[model samples]
Target: MNWRMTRYTYWMVLAVLSFGPEAAGATWHVDDSNTSAPWTGADWDNPFQYLQDALDAATAGDTIKVAQGTYHPDDATQNHTEGDRSETFLMQSGVVIQGGYIGYDNESPPPDTRDWELY
Candidate 1:
């Protein structure tokens, strides 16, 4: 293959691999401090309380949007528990986990501000 042909083939392969079967899907929300019940995790209005819950409900191409707060894997309730809590979070491939949401409400023209902290 010529130099140009090789370069074109390489880019085509890369594009196919990157945007192949894994495409952007639904977006789920998680607010650990949210006291509301009947969590659906569909949107910010009805967000899940725990990050794990969101992850569990997410698919390969889904995106999980987490609100600003400290989360502990050992705490199923997503509350602040004192002790040496150690747990692993199993993430699925092609799933995106984004944080730094200021509130549960999805405001139009979202404020250019975020407050995310991990403990």
Candidate 2:
């Protein structure tokens, strides 16, 4: 290819690599306090009850948005070793974890209603 074409292609490749696969991923919702059935964590209206459920349903580049609540790694049916730090709630590579949700029912919660808390 010509120099200009080669440069353009190089830049395109760089952009793709920099963004990675997660750039176009979807957002998943998790609310342990939610009583929604058939928990799929697909949307805020029907969120999974456990963080691990959302994580299991998520893929690389996807974001897991969790509601405010205490989450125990074991509560999600995750196998945990007492002292295995590496296995403790280890998130998928490239996945993003966001928390602090007011979890309003029936209607979508406003952005301002969302709050952050440490688990």
Candidates' C-alpha lDDT: 0.73, 0.72
Count of backbone collisions in candidate 2: 1
Give the winner by TM-score. 2
Q: Write the per-residue lDDT of candidate 2 for residues 1-119, one digit (tens) a residue.
A: 59999999999999999988644798888877787586777777778887877777788889888877777665664455434445556578879988777663535455225667522
Clashes of each: 0, 1
Model 1: runs farther than 4 Å from truth?
1-23, 77-84, 105-119
Which ranges in model 2 have alpha carbons more than 4 Å from their true place? Answer: 1-23, 77-87, 104-112, 117-119
Lowest lDDT 10-residue stretch of candidate 1: 110-119
Query: In candidate 1, what are the lDDT values of residues 1-119, reduced to their tens digit?
Result: 69999999999999889976744599998877677786888877788887777877888889888887777665454533535456766567878998888647547435223556521
